[model samples]
Target: MNRSIDIFDTTLRDGTQGEKVAFSAEDKLRIARQLDAFGINYIEGGWPGSNPRDMEFFELAADASFEHARIVAFGSTCRAGASPEEDRNLRLLVEAGTSVVCIFGKSWLLHVEKALQITAGQNLEIIRDSVGFLKQHGKEVIYDAEHFFDGYKSDPEYALSTLKAAEEAGADTVVLCDTNGGTLPHEISEIVAEVHKRVDIPVGIHAHNDCELGVANAMAAVRSGCTHVQGTVNGYGERCGNTNLCSLIPNLQLKQDYECIPDEKLEELTALSRFVSELANLNPDIRQPYVGRSAFAHKGGIHVSAVMKNEDTYEHVPPSRVGNSRRVLVSDLSGRSNISYKAEQLGIKLDKYGDNVSEIVQKLKELENKGYQFEAAEASFELLVKRMTGVWEEFFKLEGFRIIVEKNVSGSSRTEATLRIKVNDQAEHCAAEGNGPVHALDKALRKALHKFYPEISNMHLNDYKVRVLNEKDGTGADVRVLIDSAEHGKSWGTVGVSHNIIDASWQALTDSFGYYLAQKQKSIQQKEVI
Candidate 1:
């Protein structure tokens, strides 16, 4: 029987050490549950006794049954000359109610001499006592040799003694940490091979990404016979980050033929990644491997054409394997095939060989030459497609609109907007005040549209981004605004462009509401069918 590799996820612990990342106790529990659902072998919650939120998380986690992963508590080893049973940190790890306890010990001689103010022998004793105490308590102990690579390079004998201490004390796993993340692949491979020769126990690799070589170094360690790999989802951690399990897991399973995560749970990878980012209130990294938005997106004409011909030409692995899909983007560099493919994706049938299609293509090129990026403005592109295909019917029309802003000397600025909209044959007038002219105008417009479509009340704008089109200093530099909105469980994005910021905002807002109504109509039609 083949032995399985362990996937130890440190997202809740090390990942929160990343800059601008903080999770509440609730957020940590939610992410922990999702990681458990993702079939990770080990889930490191955090340093339980160090923070209230982490302590709460461990208490909450103990009550729930993990489907696959074992919860682990993390902390430093017992202090020098102290019994592990009396060490506060070690006791906290045990009280966290986890099956496994991971403790870090100073492996670098410099850290022992300067940081801990202790000799190398005392550091070894700390490791031995900590691991032995934890094991005596019937808990699986993982000893993380902190700064193991740099320690080995600085004093090989001292670092080897640290591992020997843990090995002799019954540590279930001895993880070599590239703490500073400065080691290269060759150095890691050589050190891991040497450690494997010296230790009789299974070795694990915990790498950081200071040199952006964490994944490469971890993979090299596996090739050198390490059985456990530790990383955070999306490479989240302090400074640069730890290794990314998103890339590591797939590589181990598909390339190395190692069982890191269960095969049946592979499809949950992307969802798990996004879910964690959401809980952390961080935007998903678009370029992350196997689980990012741009992982399978094809933009260049040559690439899209080739991908449409044979997906393997551009993609090393199938997108579906990781719960992602291939996307063919339309842009100035796009060929007719890219546009036609995008149209098909939007459920718009266009005659690729007809005059109308050629006209739309030429118009698209002309607009792109004027600095309209269709890829980022997909909602506008969809509206254009509907118009060209004669599938869109205007339900209402805009007559005129004016916005006024007044700044008070002793108070805040006030914005009042007025709108005159024509609904069918009748005209309706509406007025509203907002914090800004755009807000006032949006409120007034939505207020008017409420007479016709009350469902617009459910729509709310989520994000807005603006980009200047040209590099010009003076007038005539067009600006673009991208708007993201959601109604119910469905979300849609729209874009607008103009020299005037308010006009661009209005265009985007109109398209957003239009898309919402379109989705509503589709849902109604589906319900009628059922």
Candidate 2:
């Protein structure tokens, strides 16, 4: 029989513990539904007895519908010396109304004595009662052996005794947690294999990323025959965060043949990863593995050429399998093949062997050598391709513009800017004031085009980043400005460079606007055709 692994997502409970990773009750509900839609096996909603946010989240989740995942309430074992029925913590776990309850208890002898202030035997009793009480209440019980690997390393006999206690008490699955996240992969495999040898129950792994081996450790546990994987989407958690399920699930399904999700639903992994980060109001890490912006982005000239011939030459798997696509970056090292490939991606056709393709590649290299980078500014590259393909459209023409800065004696400053432009043979002059020169210039330019392209108002610059190209050049250092613009729900990036900061900002700003206009035009034309 083919092996199957259960994917347990803890983004709601453990992921919220990450620094600056707070989620409202509504945010938790939203994420829970997304996880469910992705066919996760289990969703640990939150600790019911911990806080109002978590308590209310469970109350809401109890009523909400989850198709593929069973909602699970997370908590610890009853307090020392407390009866299982009367312990407020355990009571809340039952009252949380989840069909499943996961409770973690002390495993290490040191933690039993120091953290719980209970005798070793009493700790075992706590484990036994906690799992048994939940099982008796007709709830599927999951027992997490907190600090299991470290405990196993410190006292193998005592750790095995804890697992034995939970298993004997009817715990459904025994989860070994690398609470400190300090165990190496081989150590985890060796220890887990030993526990599986002695215990007769399903095994699970929950790891943290303190040692940066969270995913590696989870995979190691699976390699050791553990059937359950617990992790947070995007690896959000306290300290260094927990295991990244985004990277682990694909590895299991594709390489290890573990079947974590249905083959069709596997592609939703990337969106699910980003959805969690978006709800947390955190900037998604573009370089994250598997589901990141740069995961399949090729910037090297040689790599892009090979990828064009055979995707397997540079990528491990088809990006479509994970809802991501291969990205070719245009830069100083780009060849004619890179230009042709990029043009094809942007819906432009070019001869595979053409003199114009070589000329465009040469021009892009010449510009990049003069401090222009198109890798992060795909909008500008598209515009460049259109120009090279002889299909470039001038949305508007810019006339000379100037800005004036005035400061008062009280140390307050004001910036004013004027812009002149022509749209469809009609000249438009506009002036605006702002808190800074760049802001003033941006407003002035937008005002000049708002009449010609009113939708430009909806396309606001979401982020602006500046990078100095030559700091050692001092006053003559060239600066590059990258602007990320958003209209409706779509976003595009554009770049510009110059010795003057304003000029660089304006160049990027202009490209951002032109990119938006070009996209709008294409969208309208497509609608008309359809």
Q: List the residue pairs that clash in candidate 2.
A: none
Best-fitting candidate, scored by lDDT: 2
lDDT of 1 at 194: 96
In terms of TM-score, how similar is model 1 to the real structure?
Answer: 0.96
Over 382-419, each residue of candidate 1 has an lDDT whose tens digit, in order, gives: 88778787888766689999999998898878899999
**Residue 361 Cα positional deviation in candidate 1, in Å, after optimal superposition:** 2.3
Each model's C-alpha lDDT?
A: 0.87, 0.91
After aligning candidate 1 to the native by TM-score, how far in Å is the CA of 398 from where it should be?
1.0
State residue 35's C-alpha deviation in candidate 2, in Å: 0.7
Predict model 2's lDDT versus the native: 0.91
